[model samples]
Target: MTRSVALLAVLAVALLTALSSIFIVDERQKALVLQFGRVVDVKEDPGLAFKLPLIQEVVYYDDRILSRDLDPIEVTPLDDRRLVVDAFARYRIADVNQFRQATGAAGDQSIAVAGRRLDSILRSQTREILGSVSSNDILSSDRAALMLRIRNGAIRDAEALGLEVIDVRLKRTDLPRENLDATFARMRAEREREATDERARGQEAAQRIRAQADRTVVELTSDARRDAEIIRGEADANRNAIFAEAYGADAEFFQFYRSLAAYRASLLEGNSTMVISPDSEFFNYLKSDLGTQ
Candidate 1:
């Protein structure tokens, strides 16, 4: 019975040993086998992997793309205007061996270490590239091109840390809180100044148009008066000519007509008295048979 118990204990120890020596590498992970705290073998392929029990251990690193959010950074543009920028980056560990060596951290802590190191690299590049351009370029659709430049600048530095920088993006760019009021005030003042200039131009045009209209009215009035005076003088001259022609054509008839017109003038609605010599020529027309036709 004691022999059977001893054999059972021996089987349990072997089973535990076998379980400890074998490890599974997931599809999403790459494992590094270390003996006595030194890297000995790498197990990148998924499936079962083996290492000496109680002598070697395995450390796994993610074999997939990762992301990190960088802290907000301030940059002064070419115009000396400062802007606050929020950004993030996407990266992948291309060389686990180099990554482990560069980070000098074991287990999951190395991932954190990589992220912190990448932050510094990206921040420096972001400041350098963004500062070289104007604020308008950073705020406009050209921002995409600026982000590409920043990513390119960081790529070289990231490679030294065994990281491949896939892309970097500027999430938000804004004026500093203190500058907002000043910017808005300046914009408002500019709009008002433009409005004033436009109104002045409109007024000047209106005045010019009014002056032209006034001049037209004065010219037209003077021209009409001169034409009326000419017409009146011509009518008077034509009537005088007709009278002179009639006098020349018949002296006796014209004299008789003139006497009759004077008679009509002397006689009025009331009784009229007129003393004249009987031999006077005024009586000639009355004396005759009512005057010639």
Candidate 2:
């Protein structure tokens, strides 16, 4: 019985030693082997790896890209316009030794610490760079260029933290609520002023058109009156010439015709009345048989 117990104890010790000597590294993970709190090995390959049991420890970090959304921060641009900016960053751990050294911790704790540091660096850079440009630049096509600059600046500073900043992007940018209200009001006032100016211009044009029309009407009326007066004068002169020619050709006949015309004018109206002596020239036509002939 004593010999059988000794063999079982040796088998049990071997199983425990075998289990403790081996560790696994997944495809998505990178591992660091630390001996007595000092990093001794880095395992980047997947599958099984061997280490001294109870003497070495393994720390695994994700090898995939990670994303972080920073909090919204307020900034003022060169134009003195205030804005609230929200941004996000994409990064990955590029150097395990540097990451370990910078974070001074392992796994999740290290990632948490790195995140805080990254936030600080990104926030500072965002403020500095954004503050140097005009608000119009932020709101224009140059926005892409500004974001690129921020990403480059972040990558430069993140290198010391063993983080490779792949990209940094602005998620949202907007004015403060009070500023937005003021801007809207200003825009409305400007539109109103433009509308007023347009109306005044329209009125001025209408007045000009009316004045032109009035002038044209006065000119046309004056021309029509002048033409009528000239035509009347010509007709009167023609009548006078015909009368003179008739008188020159036959004075007796002309006198007889003139007396008849005068008699007709004085007696044509039913209510017309005239008083004259029988010897008057106006009565000569009425009394003479020559008028009838």
lDDT score, candidate 1: 0.91
Worst 10-residue lDDT window for candidate 2 reads: 284-293
lDDT of 2 at 8: 96
Q: Against the unseen true structure, what C-alpha lDDT does each candidate score? A: 0.91, 0.92
Estimate, for each residue in 1-293, the C-alpha lDDT of model 2 and write its tens digit.
Answer: 99999999999999999899899999898999999999999998999999999999899998899998999999999999999999999999999889999999999999999999999999998999999999988877558888888999999999999999999999989999999999999999999999999999999999999999999999999999999999999999999999899999999899888877777777886787667676776776566677643
Deviation from native of the Cα of residue 109 in model 1, angstroms: 3.0
In terms of lDDT, the best-performing candidate is 2
Superposed Cα deviation of residue 208, candidate 1 (Å) = 1.7
Q: Which residue pairs come into collision in candidate 2?
A: none
Model 2 spans > 4 angstroms off: 1-16, 232-293
Q: How far is candidate 1 from the true structure (C-alpha RMSD, Å)?
A: 6.5
**Could you tally the backbone clashes for each prediction?**
0, 0
Q: Give all TM-scores, in the order shown.
A: 0.69, 0.73
